[model samples]
Structure formats: structure tokens, C-alpha cells
Target: MKDYPQSVRRKDRQETDTSFLHEILDNAVSCSIAIEKEGYPLIHVAFYHFDAANNDIIFHFSKHGHAGDEITDGKKASISIYKYGRLYTAAKAVDFGCEYQSVIIYGTIRIIEGEQERMQAMSDFFDRYFAHIPDSSYEAFTAAQSKPIHVAKLRIEQWFGKEHALPAIATDAFFPAFPSVMQPREA
Candidate 1:
């Protein structure tokens, strides 16, 4: 990873372990990318695959979508992935905070070209989301590739990981568990 100027205010919450960063990237469900388009911020959320081999991130969008229209080749962008945990409550309102782990990647985007590379990139993306399915299922993905989709890769130049967590034991400062799923309401 290229060295970038440190900007995180809380050094205690900053994480430097490469393995931990990789783990978060592998498990994060989705990521948001921020780009500057015509002096305005354009943020797009999408499912992505962390390309460990090339140290890049891969994603796709409809060719007619806003992202496809605004994202030019070699555009500078930042990607963020995060997971939230418990919400900690304190006697002082200012102290209240939530547990979270996140990574922010600064990189440049490239629109992928050529049939073979695009097919492989999309295939890797499919496997990341549906690894349990058999190879035969890939036929469906292959068929879908004919649609008007723009595949792009983010070449990572720098990245930083940060986390804030609470102790396992409960204390006066109560930390409520964050629900992973919402329950259905019953009459």
C-alpha cells in the first residue's frame, strides 16, 4: 500500500493490521464510492469484490446509470466499507457513540474493456456473492453479461482502517446490541 498522509484524528481507533483490513474487505456486503463530478460530490453504493490479486476493487453498473455517465476513465475516487455493532450510551450525551469497523480506500478508477477481462471480472464478482452455487450456475451470469453494463476497477493507492469497540462485560455505560435483522410486526 502506498503511504498517504495520516488524517485520522483518533490514533487510538486507527487500525494498521493488513490482515484485519483484508478480512473486513472480504466480508463487507457493500461499499460506497465518492467521486467529484463537476464540482459536486457523487456518491454511489454497489456490491463489490475485493480483488486481492491486483489489490483493486471491482464493481459494475448499468451503462445508462448516473455512475456510468459521470465516472470517466482514471477518475479519482474513494471507497468506504463499514460494519456497525453496539450502540454505547453514556451519562453525558457527548460521550454516546456506536461501535464500528471501517476502511476507506483512496484510488483511481478504470473502466474495464475487452470481452475476456470483463467476463473474468464479472465472474469473480458472482463467485464472491454466490460461492455456494455450483459452476453450472455461472451460465446464468454469462448470459446476463450481454446486457449493457459498465465494469470498472478501482486501483487502490492508499487505505486506512479504523475501529471503535466496547468491552465484552457490561458496565454503567450501557451498550445495547445492534440488531442484525428486524422482526416482523404482529397484530
Candidate 2:
């Protein structure tokens, strides 16, 4: 798919599964993680890297509040991945359709330890988020900064995904846009 055309030009209720997640991860960089500490709601906006084999999305953050300490075991962590890529025309805000791909995964996160695993986790994040990090920078990442901080990883348990686009009418019209669902397929 060159763009979200399949989702926009037509609507047929595109199905999704683990395969779809890999695509979303490639296009996404940041995810919102909502956690609660001491009965208070906490939301962390952090960068993450997705792993296909283990179906896990990993994160490393500086020692903040009790890192992953308060949540119940197997609790759901809501993580949303979103995108809006030139789906709207500049002149018209109501061109009501947006080219968007999003996935909300409710997963269980585990606090990771072990020096070797920690090092690998951080390295994996660098390769995914900053593929352009030079060799020297990578060395620095592994050598010095890998320690002192903490890493928490979320294992993807279930995900809900949707792909969206504007209908042809809205695509041609200049303004006064409204979102329209695709008509059902004929029997």
C-alpha cells in the first residue's frame, strides 16, 4: 500500500492481527503509557522499540517515581500508536477524512534486570529509534549511559487496530468535510 488509500478510498473493515503490528511499529516512534502509582493516575510519554519475536515493546526511562512498582501483576497498560500523514488538505479543515493508522495494545509490563539483558535492551532501542546513531555514539550508549537508569518492558497481549481514510466525495470537495463510513459489500 503506497498510502492509506485502501482505508480512505474505500471502507471494507480491514482485519488486523500481529502481522499488522509490525507495520504500525515501523511507522510509529512515540507511545503514551498510562500507569498508576499509589492510586494516582500517571501517564508517561516515552519512546519505544517493538520486538517481533517476543511480541514485546520495550522502554527505558531515567529513575523516576517507583518504576513499575505499583501496578498489579498482569494489569493492562494502555499504549496508543497514532499517525496523521498529510491526510487533510491545507485549505480545508473539514475535508473531514484523515489518513490515519493506529493501534491500542493492552499489555503486561515487567521490570527487567540482569546486566547483559539491560545492555541489549538499550541497544535495541537505539537501533530502532535512532538507526543513524554512529558507531561512536553506540559505544557511548553501551559503555556509560546504559547504567544508572532503569528499563521496563511491556509484552503485547492483545491489540485493537484500525486503518482509516476519507471517502471520494470528501476527497474532491474543498470544505465542510464530515467523516463517512464505507458502505457494506453487496451480497
Candidate 3:
């Protein structure tokens, strides 16, 4: 594995463990991919497969969509996958923060065009999300359903992982504000 460029802003929070990076990718249900097009940055949420074997990510987009139109082979893109954690509060406003594990990947996108490879990538994607189905029927089903889908592989050139955590000590009579997901609902 090659060394990724470190973020000078938060050197302490950068994560290097490859296992932790895989965990974040495997556990995430969706990712945000940012692509630059004509001086504009377009970000879209997509369902992706983390190919640990190839050290890349694969995803599908609708044919004739903005992604298919804007993104092509060798295009540069950035991917972000994250897991949100609890909010951390402090007596001082500047100290307030939140816990999170996130990874940013810089890569060149490759559009899988070969019939065999495209089908295989599509199969891998379906198998990841639909593991319950047996392989006997998977091939036939995928072949029939894959016609309208376009698959692209993001070949990871570099990536950085970061995690922010609060020290395990209580502040002086301070109450931490909970995240919206953790807050109670109103009747």
C-alpha cells in the first residue's frame, strides 16, 4: 500500500489502518461521488460495491443520466464514505464537536465496456447487495436485467481516512447535545 497525502489541517485525526478503511466502506450503505464538469462540481449519492480485491469501488448509473453523460473513462472523481457518531459538547463553544469516521478517495473513473467484464462487475455488485440469492440463478437474472445499467469502476489512486473522537472525560457540569437521530420525537 502506498502512503496517502496527509491533511495538514487535522494530522492527529488521520487514520491509516487498511482494515478500518475497509470496515467503513463495507458498512456504508451509500457514498457521495464528486465529479468536476465544466467548472462545476457535481455530487451524487450512489450505491457502491467496495472491491477489496482490486482496491477500488464500483457503482452503476442509469443510462443517459447526468452521471453517464458527464462521467467517462479516465475522468477524475472523489468519493466520500462516512459513519456518523455522537455529538460531543463542551463548556466552551469552540470545543463543541462530533465524532465521525470518514474516508475520502481520489481516483480515475473507468467505464467498464467489455461484455464479459461488465457483466462480472455487475454480478459482483448484485451478489454483495443480494447475497441471499443462490448463484445458480444469479447469472441468468443479471444478464437479463443488466442491459439498461451502466457500470463504472473508480480506480483508487489515493485515499485518506479520518476519525474524530472526544476524550473520555466529562466536562464540568456540561450537557452534551444529542444528534437529531438520537433525540426523542414529539407526539
Candidate 4:
């Protein structure tokens, strides 16, 4: 519920806007979830389900991982999604640079208990990753996998973002206003 300005101040070269943030969430199928255990940082890669409607994130893992165990305990986890925006440049006579957008979400994890919540979260994941599935197959496949997976929801506390631009001033919807920075010249 907390806005970007109230959460944490981030410094980056990319303009964090609404559209850019949405794109990063769209392009990414999985997210790297970072948590801490016994004072050490534990980061695990996870397939994520995002709800743009309420800006919520969902993830599921077997009862195995330490992250699942250490999720609550008054500590929050961080999840990030990014893309490799590599390209070649002709005028510069070199590869200019890769452009990318990323979103960092801070939230508390709550283990999903009811079948309804779990199935709904799974549905979100299915829509994002398997949008191409045929109607019958999709329903059947979901029915099969639904009972097997244990879904959990991440209640977002706050969020922030960063990204790269080609012209350095490209505007987007999900990202915030990116301040232009001048790289320091070597003496």
C-alpha cells in the first residue's frame, strides 16, 4: 500500500515509470526472491505470479526450501525481474549498451491456506505463462496440477524500480520519473 516515495529512495540511471514497471513484470516469467536466514542472506530463484490489478505477487514452492520457512518471522523478502536488452549499434561502431527494466518488490509472505486462494494464484500464473494454451487443455492441465502445488501470496508492503532507455528519455507507464545522469569522464 505504501507508495514509492514512502518506501525507499532508489538511485539508478533509468526512468522508473508505470509502463516500464508493467513491462518488466510482463517480460519476466520468474523472479529471484531474496530472503535472510540466521543473519545470512538467502536468495532463491522462483516462478512468480503477478497481479497488476492490485500490484500483488504470488509464488509457490514445496515445503522443502529454507526460504519458505524463513519467509515470515518479522522479515520481508525482495523479488526482482530483469531482461537482457542487448543490441548492436552501427553509428557508434560498437555495441552501445543493453537496455532493460526491472522491478524490486518488498513484501511479507503469507502461506495460502484455502483451496480458493491457492487456485486463484495458480490461475494468475497460468495466465501469465500459459496464455497460449487451448481452453480444454488448459482447464484439464490446471485441474491436474492444482492439487499438487502449494501456493503462497506475497502481500506487497512497498515497491520501486529502475530501467535503461535507448534515447535516455523514453517515457513509460509503470516506471517513475528517471532523472538524467551524466557519467563522469576519466581524467
- Score each candidate by Cα lDDT: 0.83, 0.67, 0.81, 0.67
What TM-score, over all chains together, does every model reach?
A: 0.84, 0.70, 0.80, 0.68
What shift in Å separates residue 47 of candidate 3 from its native position after superposition? Answer: 0.9
Q: State the lDDT at 55 in candidate 3.
A: 90
lDDT of 1 by residue, 33-75 (tens): 9988877899999999999889999988878878878877988
Candidate 4 C-alpha lDDT tens digits along 65-178: 575566653456778887755342334535355566777888877777787777778777777778797887633445456665557667677666776656433332233334
**Relative to the unseen true structure, what is the C-alpha lDDT of residue 37 in candidate 3, on a scale of 0 to 100?**
83
Best by lDDT, which number? Answer: 1
Superior by lDDT: candidate 1 or candidate 3:
1
Mind giving the per-residue lDDT tens digits that candidate 3 earns over 5-118? 556368888988898889899988789999888788888788999999899899888777788788788878889999876676577767767778998998989988888988
After superposition, candidate 3 runs with Cα above 4 Å error: 1-8, 133-140, 168-187
Candidate 4: minimum summed lDDT over ten consecutive residues — where? 168-177
The local distance difference test score of model 2 is 0.67
Worst 10 residues of 1 by lDDT: 167-176
Question: Which structure is stronger by TM-score: 3 or 4?
Answer: 3
Candidate 2 lDDT, 65-164, residue by residue in tens: 5543543345557787877543445345655555667877777877677888878888788777677857765345554656667777889876767776
Superior by TM-score: candidate 1 or candidate 2: 1
